[model samples]
Target: MRAVQVTEFGGPEVLTPVELPEPEPRDGQVLIAVDHIGVNYADTHQAENSYLAPSKLPLVPGGEVVGRTADGSRVVALLNGGGYAEKAVARQDWAFPVPDEVDDLTALSFIVQGSTAWLLLRRSAHLAEGESVVVHAAAGGVGSIAVQLAKAWGAGRVIATASSAAKRELALELGADVAVDSRAEDMTATLLEANGGKPVDIVLDMTGGSTTDGSIKALAPFGRLAFYGMASREQPKPVELRNLLGHSTTIAGMWLPHVFTLPGNVFGEAMADLFALATAGEIRAVAGGEYGLSEARAAHEALRARGTTGKLMLDPKR
Candidate 1:
């Protein structure tokens, strides 16, 4: 098997393709012949050794994969690591059947980003119908899905924040009621103006640092801010306690692992629901780019440069 491995933590240059023995699935696990592997910001963090989770060196870096199980059933699987390989093992509990209508790349894109958006809206923020939501990085993988999910959930107004004009246009095409360029002026001001000077009820905050502060300011009284990722490249600023004092707003941190660990078949039900949405065309996977396994370094570079929008994939068959 060919896999991208990090012998040591560094940059995109540190990711190198190497041959490894094929892995066998243990009990209660499934062996997948990987077709498409989703590249996430988490992958970059792991490659740089800045990930919040502990990691071992000489690691194969990937979290989500869309492929086939031993019985040749198409499926999407989440892994702790080792997804960068041509073949990987995934716990059966962490795997979901891919609908016949969902192609490999598309299925792969939705499993991670779609699930994150779905969980954030339905669980973390407890988003209500007719409530307004502001999605940061609206052109990126998770942001695009978040925008669609917010619209599907009947948000009164979906305001998207993007860095470029192209990205803003893309967001508008994807059901965003309004789009703002977060790089210019103040994001909160733009969001308020777009919403007729009304604060948003929820904020899907993927960009941290100063943007987190602005997001907190843009919330309506009792609004929820679900912080998921840190794409701003700025260290997180200390949040003022008073920001939430009178408003009764809440700042909740969301990590998918927590949601997947919920008791009594919660994770299975959520995955099944997301798969149904994909089958119904209510939600989708936006695969922005696909690269061959050997081009792993280039994929990392593209993500690091922030030059790509939507989900990126590695095709082992390519």
Candidate 2:
């Protein structure tokens, strides 16, 4: 099997393509002939050992995969690791059968990016009808879907923010009511202006640093902000609980892995809903560039540089 391995902690340059022996499945696991692998920001963090969890040496840096099982079932699995290869193993419970109406890339989209977008809006933010929303980094995988989901779920207004005009334009195409500059000098003012000079009800932010601070400042009374990732590689100013008393605002943190710990089908239920939406043509997955298994380095380089939009993918068989 051909795979990309990271032996040292650094950047995209560390991902090396190599030939490795095929992995065997255990009792509860099934072997998959990988078709397409989903690349995510977490993959970059995993390669550089900057993720929430520490990674071991010689790690294969992909988690979501769309492949065929030994029984000829086409499925998508979200694994712990080792997805960047021609052959990978996934636990039976971790793999879900992809609907015939959904293509491999579309199924791959919902596993990590789509699920997070659903949980961020439906669970963490507790979105309500007729409420305003702010989606940061709105052209990326999670952001792109979040923008559409916010509107589909009956948000009164959806404001999208992105670093470039082209990305913002894509957000608007995805159903965001308004698009604003994410690199604005005053993010709070930018958001307020986009929302018709009013505070927003919900905000989904993955970019940390001042963006987080600005989102908090722009929250309306009882507004909710779901902070998920620190894409900016910077931390926001320390927050004071005392100040939250004024607006009764709430800041909730979401880590997808933790949601799995709850004794329910949270992950599965979300995946099913996303797949249905994709099948019904209610939402479309925005795809970025596709890379072969060997071009993993270039994929990571583009992702880390924020030079790509939507979902980045790798073709393991290529």
Candidate 3:
């Protein structure tokens, strides 16, 4: 099996392809012949040795994959690492059967980003029908999914923020009622106006630093701000506790791995619901680009340069 490894974290140049022995599955685990592997911002963080969790050196940096089990059944799996390979071993419980209706790359792209968007809209923020939502990085993997999920969930107004005009237009195409350049002055004001001069009921914030602070100010009373990703590379700023004095605003963080730690049935139920949504065409995974396993380095570089719009994948069999 060929895999991309980061022997020492630094930059995309560190992701070198190498041939490795195939992995065997243990009891309660399944071995997947990886067809497509999803690449995310998390992968770049891992490559640069800047992830929230400490990563071991010489690591194969991938978190989500779509492939088949030994019996040749299609499935998608979430892993701690090693997804950028031709083969991977995953816990049986962590793997979800891919529906015949979903293609391999689409299924792989949905596992991480789709699930996170589902959880954020349905669980974390408790998004309500006809309420308004504001999502950052609306052209990226999770952002694109978040926009669609927000609309499907019946959000009356969905405002998306992106860095460029092209990305802003893409966000609008993905179901955002309005798109704003977060880098512009008075972005919060623009977002509020887009929502009919009312503060949003929920904010799905991926960019931290100053943007997080601004998002807090843009929330409605009793609103929830779900802080999930930190793409801005800015140190977290202090929130004015006084800002919440008259408001019932709350800040929460989310990690998908925590879902696995829930009681057995809970994890299964949520994933099943996610799959159902995908199968029903209520949500679509955006696979931005595809590359062969050997081109993993180029994929990372694209992601690092913010050159891609949606989810990126590596086709291991190519």
Candidate 4:
């Protein structure tokens, strides 16, 4: 089996390709012949050893995969690591069947970005109908899906923030009411103006640090900000207690591993719902680029530079 492993964490260059023995599935696990792998910002973190989660050296850094079993069942999976390989084992519950209409790359997106968008909006934030929402990093993997899911979940107005013109356009094409530059000097101003000169009811924040501060400022009275990944990888800026207290604002943090580790099958249920949406043509995975296993470094660089408009993928067989 061929895999990309970071023997010593440093930079994207450390994601070197190597030959490795295929992993066997454990009692409650399934071994997948990976067809497509989703390249997430977390992969960049794992490559740099900056991710908050525990990790060890000689790590294969990938968390989402789309593949088929020996029985020919196409499934998407969420793994702790080792998804950069052609064959990887994952917990049985972590694997969800991919609909016939969904391709390998799209199925890969369903596990990570898709579930994140679905769970964060539908469950964590409890986004209600007719609520005005704002999505940070709105053209990236989770954010791109979120822009659509927010509207599908009944958000009346969805404003998107991105660093590039292409991403902003992609966000709007995905159904955002407005799109603005996240790198703008006055993010709150642009976001507010886009929202018809009003604060947003729900803010989906991906990059932490300064972006989080802007999210805090952009919330409406009694609004919620669902914080997920810190794509910026900067030390998080503390949210002033007064900020939340002033408008009855709430800052909610989410980590998918934590959700999957919870008592019941919250992860499984969410994927089911997301797939149903895909089947109904409500939500989808917008593919940005596809790379071979050896091109893992390029994928990470692209993700870090925030140049992609949708999900980036790694194909071990490529």
What TM-score, over all chains together, does every model reach? 0.96, 0.98, 0.95, 0.96
lDDT of 2 by residue, 83-189 (tens): 99998988888899999889877888899999999999999999999999999999999999999898889999999999899999999999999999889989999
| Residue pairs clashing, model 2 | none
Model 1 segments more than 4 A misplaced: none
| Candidate 2, position 305, lDDT | 89
lDDT of each: 0.85, 0.92, 0.84, 0.86
Question: Cα lDDT of model 1 overall?
Answer: 0.85
Write one digit per residue (lDDT tens) for candidate 3, span 119-184: 788778998899899998889898998998899879989999988999999999888999988786
Error of 1 at 15 (Å): 0.5
lDDT of 1 by residue, 1-318 (tens): 898889999889999989999988889989999988989988998998887897788899999898888788988999989999899999998888877877876677667777788888888899999999999988889899899888887999999988889989999998999998878567678778888999889999878887887778888998999999887667667767886788888988888888756778766776777777777888776667999988989998998887788999998876
Deviation (Å) of 91 in candidate 4? 0.8
lDDT of model number 3 = 0.84
Worst 10 residues of 1 by lDDT: 260-269
Candidate 4's displacement at residue 318, Å, is 2.4
Task: Please give the TM-score that candidate 4 achieves against the real structure.
Answer: 0.96
Count of clashes in candidate 4: 0
lDDT of 4: 0.86
Give a tens-digit lDDT track for model 4, residues 1-318: 999988887888888899999998889999999988888888887778777786798788899888888788888888989999999888888888888987876787778888888888977788999999889989888999999998887889999998888889999999998898998777777778988989889888888777777777878898998988887776567778986797899889887778857778888888888788888999878988999999999988887877887888988887
